[model samples]
Target chain A: MTETELLDALKAALGADVLAAGGVGHDLWAQVAKGRVREALQLFKGTLGFNVLVDHTAADLLKWPGGHWAGVWDPCQATQGGEHERRTQTDGRFELTWRLMRLDEKSGLVEGRAALKCRVSDGEAGPPSVRDLWPCADWLEREVWDMFGVKPNNRPDLKRLLLYEEFKGHPLRKDYPIAKRQPLVAPLPAPEGRIAPEQLRPRVTDPGLVE
Target chain B: MTDERDPQTPGPGSGALTQGSGPPGVLTSRLDAAIGWARKYSIFQYPFVTACCGMEYMSVASGHYDMDRFGAGFPRFSPRQADVLMVVGTTSQKIAPILKRIYEQMMEPKWVVAFGVCTCTGGFYDDYATVQGIDTIIPVDLYIPGCPPRPENVLQGLMLLQEKIQRQGLHPKPGTLRPPIR
Candidate 1:
C-alpha cells in the first residue's frame, strides 16, 4: 500500500491517538500519543503487515527552549541534515522511535517502510515493551533504557548492556557529564604463574654436531 | 708448588695493562660494578600494551628493529618473571590499578619504562577517564615521548634504562634509591 493509504487507514483505526502523519523524505512517518504507542505499533504489525521491526532508538530532548523540543525548522536539526529534522524534537522530553518495514512474501522484497515516533516525558514511563510481538525488540528496548533511561513497561531484562554495572549514569543523556569518571575501587584479579621463555636446544642427531 | 714465573710480574700477553701487579691474569672491579653489568645486559620485559603504541612495540620486537640486540627482546606475559615493565599506550583510570598490581607483582630489581606519550602523560585524552600520568601510581624509570613512539625511540629508552641499571647499585628492596649516575 502507498504511504497515504496506510496513513489514512491508521488515522481511521487509531483516530485521536494518531496525532500527525506526513512524509519524512521518501518514507511515511506518524507521531502518536505516548499512551497509545503499543496499540498503534500492534496495528502496524498485525493489520498493515509491517512485520519487520527495522530499528528502535531514542533521543534526549532536554536542551530545547522552555522544554520545547526543536522541530524541522529548528537550527539544532541542521547539525545532522534536513532528512533528520522532522523527528528531532520532543518538546523537553525523550522521543522514542521505531522503523518498521513491510516485506512482500512472494517476491521477498520490501514493499513499504514507516517511522513511528512517540514523545515520552522525563520521569514518565515509556511505551510498553514490544518484545512479545518482535523478539528483536528485547535488546533494542534494553539499549534505549541503558542510553536514555527510558523505562519500557514489562521488559524482563532491562539491565545495562553497553556500560558496566558500576557506571553511574546513562552516557547518552544530555545532562551526563562528559568528563566524569567512575573508576572501579578494586581491580579484577589477574592470572597467577610465571611464563618462561621458549627454550632452544640443538638436535643431537645432526651429523655435523655429533662428530 | 709454584712455577718458575714470579707472582709479582705481569704475565705474557698482559700488555702492560696490569694495575699494581695484584694477581696475574686476574681483573679487579667493585662488587657493585660487576652486579650492575650483569643486570644491565638481561632485561626481561613485560609489555603492558593497551593501545595504538603496541604497533610500534611490535616493530621493535620484530626482526627489523631487533630489540634482542639490547637484551630486552623477551616479552614476558607474567609479571613475576619480568625484570622491566614497559607500559606502551594510553592507560585509562579503570586500568591504572591493574597496572599498579602488575608493577607490584614483579620481583625486586624491577624497573618501569613508559614507552609512549600516552603512558607518560595521558597524551590527548586529558579527561577523567584517562590517568594523567602513570607516575602517580608507580615510579617510572624512563619516559619515551611520542604519540605512538617510533621503534627507534623505544630502543633508545631501553638503552637509557640499561645505562641507569649499570650506574646504580642493586638494593635489597625494589624501590630503594641509588647514588646518581655521573
Candidate 2:
C-alpha cells in the first residue's frame, strides 16, 4: 500500500506495543516495547512485505548525555541549545535499532524502509530473538551480544562474531575501560610432528662435513 | 663436495653447483654465506594482511614496485611455506592468537615485519579491542610506522627484513622469538 498504511498496519496489529510512531519523508520509524520486538518484526515480514532486515545494532547510552541522536526523530523530543538534556530511554541503558526495508512486489526495486527501535536496559534478559523471523538476525544478534553485552533470548548459537572467545568485557559499553586488556591464550606451542628448529638447521662447522 | 677440498679444489658438479648456485646451494650453503644470501633474497613471505595496509602491500608487491627484484616476490599463503611473516596491518586482539599460531607454524629462521603503525604501536586504534602492539604477543623484527605506510616505507621494511634474514644465520633457537638486534 502507501508508506502511511504500513506503519498504520503495525500500529493496528501491535496496538500499545507501538509506543511512538513518526516519519519525516519516507524514513518511517517506531518505538516498540522491548518484549514485543519479535512480534513487531514478524508483522513487518509476514504481512507487510518488509523482508530485508537492513541492520540490527545497539547503542550504549550510559554516557550519551542525550538529546537528538542524529535522526530528525519527533521535533518535540529534540532538546534545544545542546545542553545535557538526557532523553528518556524507557529506563534502559541500551537501544536496539532494527531497520527493515521491503522490495517492490512487481518491479523488485526497494520501495521504502522502516526503523524499529526498542530499548533494553541492563539487569533485563535482553530482548527476544528475531532470528526465528530472519536467519540473518542470527549473526547480527550475536554481534550485538559480542559488542554490547546484550544477549537476545532464545538465540541458539550466540557465540562471539568479531572478538575471540577469551575476550572479557564488551568494549562497546561506555563504562568498559579503554586500555584494559585480558591476557591472551598463551602463544601455542609448535604443532606436533613438526621438525624442531634446531633440527631444521643443524650446526655444521667441520669444512669436511660439506663433502 | 668437500669444504676442506675447498674453493681451490674445483672438481665438482658442473659448478653441478651452478644450477642452483641453489638447491645444491641449500645443501652446500650450509657454509653460511650462500644460504644466508639465498634466504635473505628469496624471502617466501607470508603476508598476514588484515587491514588497509594491505592495499599498500599489494601496490608494493605489484609490477610497479617489483618486489620480485628483492627476491621476496612470491607470497606463500601457508605459514609453513613462508619464512617471513609480513604482518601487514592491524592485528586486533581477536587475530592475535591466530597470528601467533601462524608464527608458530612457520619454519625456523623466520622473520616478522610489523608493516604499519597500527601493527607497530596500535596506531589510532588505541582501544581495548585492538592488541596494543603485536609485539606484545608475537616477536617483531622490524616496525614500519605510518598510518598504513607509503609503498616506499613498506619496501624499506622489506629491505630491513632481508638484512635481518641475512644475520639470523643457520644457527637455530627452537621457539624463543627474539627482538631485532639494534
Candidate 3:
C-alpha cells in the first residue's frame, strides 16, 4: 500500500490515539499517544505488512529548544527551518522513536518504511515492550532503559546493555554530570575462575599490588 | 740495539687499537651501558590497541615503516611476556580497569608507551566516557603526540625510549626511584 493509504487506514482504525500524521519524504511519519504504541505497532506489523522493525531508540527532550516533539522532527522537510517560537513545558520527557519497514516476501526488497514516535514522560513508565512482535526490540529496549532510564513495561530482562552493573546513573540523561567519575575500587575477579595453580616455591616473596 | 718504534709509542698502523689507549685489547665500559645496549634492542611489546589509532599502529608495524627495526616489532599477546606496554588508542572509562589489570600483570622493569594523542591525553573526547589520560590509571614512560601519529614520529619516540633505557642502573637500589621520563 502507498504511504497515504496506510496512514488513512491508521487514522480510521486509531482515530483519537494518533496525535499527528503526515508524509516525510517517501515514508509516512506519525506521533501517537504513548499508551497506544503497542496497538499501533501491532496493526502495522500484522495487518499492513510492515513486518520489519528497522530501528528503535529514544531521544532525551528535556533541554530541546524547539519542544519535546521537535526532537524527532525531520530536518529534511522544507517547512522545518524557519524561525520558530519555543513552547517550554514545565515537565521533562523523552521521545521514543521506532522505524518500521515492509519488505516483499519473494524479492526480499524493502517496499516501504514508516517512522512512528511517542512521548514518554520522565519518571513514569515507558511504552510497552514490543519484544514479542519483534525480537530485536529486546536489546534496543534494554539500551533505552540503560541510557535514558525509560523502563519498558513487561520487559523480561532489562539489564544495562552498555554500562557496567555498578554504574549508578544513566549517563545519557541531560541531568547527568559530564565530569562525574565513578572509578572502580578494585578489579573484579576473572569470570572464568582460576586458570593456573598457585606456585609452591617462589624466588621473590613480595609481589606488590598496582596502585 | 734500540728499536725504531718505542714500546709505549704505538706504530703508525695501530691507530685503531690505540684510540682509547686504556689497554691493548680489553674494552672497559659501565655495567649499565652494556645492559642498556642489550635491553634497548629487544623490547617485547604488548599493543593495547582499541580505536582508529590502531590503523596508524598497523602502518608502523607493517613493512613500509617497519617497527621491527626498533626492537618493538614483536607484539606479545599476553601481558606476562611483554616488556613494553604500547597503549595505541582511546581508552574509555569502561576499558580503564581492564587496561590497568593488563599493565599490572606485566612483569616488573616493564615500561609503558602511550602511542597516540587519545591514549596520551584523550584527544578531542573530553567527556565522561573517555578516561582523560591513561597516566591517571598507570605510569607512562613515553608519550607520542599526534591525532594518529605518523610512523616516523613513532620511530622517534622509540629512539627516545631506547635512550631512557640506556641510562638506567642495571639493578636499582632498594627504595630508589627511577628518574621519570619527560
Q: Which candidate should be chosen as best, given lDDT against the real structure?
A: 3
Q: Cα miss at A73, model 3 (Å)? A: 7.2
Encode model 3's per-residue lDDT on B1-182: one tens digit a residue: 11123446656423222223245556544566667767878999999999998999999999999989888789999999998899999998888989999988998778889989988767877665777667767777788989899889999999888777765647522212223446
* C-alpha positional error of residue B62 in candidate 1 after TM-score superposition, expressed in Å: 1.9
Please report the candidate that would top TM-score against the real structure: 3
Using TM-score, rank the candidates from best to worst: 3, 2, 1
Q: Residue A11 CA error for candidate 1 (Å)?
A: 6.6
Could you tell me the TM-score of chain A in candidate 1? Answer: 0.74
What are the clashing pairs of model 3? none
Candidate 3 per-residue lDDT, tens place, A147-203, comes to 899978776458998777778999888777755667653423322332321422422
In candidate 2, stretches whose alpha carbon ends up further than 4 angstroms from where it belongs are A1-3, A66-89, A105-108, A185-211, B1-35, B167-182
lDDT of 3 at B121: 66
**Whole-model lDDT values for every prediction:** 0.74, 0.73, 0.75
On the 0 to 100 scale, the lDDT of residue A33 in model 1 is: 81
Give the poorly placed runs of model 1, Cα more than 4 Å off. Answer: A1-58, A66-89, A97-117, A128-147, A185-211, B1-24, B172-182
**lDDT of residue B22 for candidate 2:** 37
Better of 1 and 2 by DockQ: 2
Residue-level lDDT tens digits of model 2 in B1-182: 34433445656322322222334335444445556666778889899999999998999999999899899899999998998888988877777878889988998877788888988767777666777667777767778888878888878777766666655556634333444545
- Once fitted onto the true fold, the runs of candidate 3 whose alpha carbons sit more than 4 angstroms away are A69-92, A104-108, A185-211, B1-26, B171-182
